[model samples]
Target: MEGLSEKLASKLHKYSVLPFEDMYGTVSPLDAFVFTNYIFFLIIAFVATLVFFVVAANKTALVPKGIGNLAETGVEFIRNLCVDSMGKEGVKFVPFIGTLFFFLLFANILGLIPGTLPATGTIGVTAAWAVMVFLLYNYIGIKKHGFIGYFKSFVPSGVREMGPLGKWGMGSFIFILEVLGHFLRPLTLAMRLFANTFAGGMILGIFGIFVVLGVKEISAIGLLSSGLSLVMLVIMYAFKLFVGVIQAYIFTLLTTAYIGGALHADEH
Candidate 1:
């Protein structure tokens, strides 16, 4: 352990760990968990959403206010999606879908904060969220279509009408494919967010390491480059913010698609 520490110390002239390593070490001060950084951001995201809505609701404006405008933007965005995807029936599920989108968007955006790890970077967090989305839509589908109807909807009856196999064969094939695809959606959704956030986090970590190493190793000349490295780190983080937003949007869009599928037995 001593030798390892020495080695890391020597390499500190050329490399550095991302910030807040000590805070998220082998055991966190908060709960002895291995991933304290993720917990921290999860709390922040939860609180941020709570605070935003609480304040937004506190003020009631006849025309429009700043917070009202912000709330309206989010509401309108989700409203448009819900209407387009699920039609009139979509209005009822707006709260569910809207909250899901905001929670994810807030969590993803939290990764851009200094000295903080993005919770979405962790596969566990992403997978849990993905699974929640999967279950909710499937529940919605089952509830609206009924068990027999929903199962039947999975098969492509239209194709059976045209072919020799008739309804039986085509329905079987489509049912199998659709079931597999449905099961796969959660995995894909989790992976997309996890991969993007992990990559962005890694990039930021690398730039931070460069800055620390340059400052330690190369005398005055290296010190100057350290400043440039810091700038690069900031730029990378800014770009990552955009990635977070896009991924969040994609996740919400896919979720809406899933819900819409559940709503329309014909589309299933």
Candidate 2:
């Protein structure tokens, strides 16, 4: 374990295997305790939501106040996106989609903090999120169209009616492919966000590596390398900040689209 740590240290300064016995670190025999980061993120998300509502509701300002303005801006931004994607009925999904966006945004941005780790970068976290989305979208579809109807929705009728694309042969294959594609949506969605955030964290770790080595060596070459590393670090951080916001938006938008599709599966 010690040797492995040393090997990892060479490549990444502040990046050790997680749960590294620091104050912010945790360990558990059951493997459940270390997953506390999920709990932490959930608490943070809940608190943030509460704070937003408290300020918005209490102030009740027509002219708008500090946090109220900010909160309203966020709300309006998301509401518009939801409406654009899911139509006027999208209003109902706004709260759920907006909350999802804010939670992910906070989680991603928190990683830029010196000691905080990104929970979203973890596979377990992303997988759980994806599963929830998959279930919700499917549930919405099934509710809208009974179970048998939902399954039947995947089979294209217009193709059979037209008798194009080599008639029945190509049509059946197209339906199967379309069904598979629908099933893979959640996997792709979750993995894309997870992979992007995880890569950003790794890039930040690389920047920290040079800084750490420079501090340890305390020499001319070390200083030069560290200086260059610092420049790269800032650029990488800026990019990550931009990407965090974009990823959160993409996730939320795609989620709305999925829900919308489910709601209207019987349509085109």
Candidate 3:
């Protein structure tokens, strides 16, 4: 075990771990020059997104040219998506949901750039987002319906309307399942994003290793493998971009569903 560990550590030590390890630290403990490590990508993502919105909003074009046009398109898509999923009440959540979508899109897309780590690649980052949405929806539900009412809405009135069938056994049974499903949404959200990004990052690192070995070894098979790896890397990165966009959309879609459910549990 020790020998294998040493050999593996010797060969794959650097590539085996997460990226952007040494980037996060404070210059001083005063919180003035505090340097954040993993959050660096998040800050960059936020700045880039803010700049985009500012440019898009400040456009002077009458017919929505350039950034303004793109912004308008994005708004239309999100608005339609939210409304279709949540009805008119979704209008209130467009800004929030749109911001969520944009932030995630930027974060995921930024990771594709060489040497940059995505915040969403980490479970902590994804969980933070999931938890925020989960809490926000729950709070909205409780605020609108009160605590008991909000929880009570988990099980249908029909389940309890059948007298003994509802009250004797089925009501409690369905309520437990309903509670589990509601709470499990956040976990599923976090794991889906985190696992996809982390796996992609690790695969890229593995390809880097293969490419280096192939180039350094000076053999026909090694050269061929290296070339194949490079080609595969390009394809994988392109797919990663698609995955990022889809994941962002999925996350926002689920967020809207949760919010819509919380706001009108009876209708759900």
Candidate No. with top lDDT:
3
Off by over 4 Å in 3: 1-36, 60-62
For each candidate, what TM-score against the reference? 0.81, 0.83, 0.86
- Per-residue lDDT tens digits of candidate 1, residues 97-192? 888888788888876776666778877778988999999998988898898888888876577466676666667777889899999999999999
- What are the per-residue Cα lDDT tens digits for candidate 3 across 4-100? 3444453334322233445222233344433344467888999999999888889837777888999989988999888987788888888999999
**Candidates' C-alpha lDDT:** 0.77, 0.75, 0.79
User: What lDDT, from 0 to 1, does candidate 2 have?
Assistant: 0.75
Model 1 CA deviation exceeding 4 Å by range:
1-36, 162-167, 219-228
Q: For candidate 2, lDDT tens digit of each residue in 19-78?
A: 534534544545765545445654665676677667776766899878778778888888
- Show the lowest summed lDDT stretch of 10 residues, model 2: 11-20
